[model samples]
Target: MRATEVAMALGEPDIHKRVEVVRTRLKRLIDKGWLAEHQRGQFSIVEGLNGAALNGAAADH
Candidate 1:
């Protein structure tokens, strides 16, 4: 997901979201291995931190 999507998931209103702030936080999470950037301006939960990982479905990724 992108920062804008993350903001929406967090319940931030469409007209009030601060994507820059969310992007900064996401970068920090990447630094800590909590998230992985899958593409430019996009991200995914790191394996082992989400259900797919727990179910062994993410091992091939």
Candidate 2:
């Protein structure tokens, strides 16, 4: 999801604050090699992180 989408998902009302939070999360994910930013404000999931366990748990929801 884009930053805006992520912000909305997190229930952020202010756009600027939303962007800030999304950017910070994205940067951290990138640093951990779990996510990559492709185009401007776009992101893609990268392999290597143990995200499967989280995904599996969420799948039951």
lDDT of each candidate versus the true structure: 0.75, 0.69
- RMSD of every candidate to native, in Å, equals 5.6, 6.1
How does model 1 fare in lDDT?
0.75
* Candidate 1 residue pairs that clash: none
lDDT per residue (tens digit) for residues 1-61 in model 1? 9888998898776653487778888998777667899999898888776434434334434
lDDT of each residue in 1-61, candidate 2, tens digit only: 6877777777887578768888798878766567778888887777445455453332212
Scored by lDDT, model 2 comes in at: 0.69
Most lDDT-accurate candidate: 1
Give the TM-scores of the predictions, in the order they appear: 0.69, 0.63
Q: Which 10-residue window of candidate 1 scores lowest in summed lDDT?
A: 51-60
TM-score of 1: 0.69
The per-residue C-alpha lDDT of model 2 at residue 25 equals 88
Tell me the spans in candidate 1 whose CA falls farther than 4 Å from its real position: 15-17, 50-61
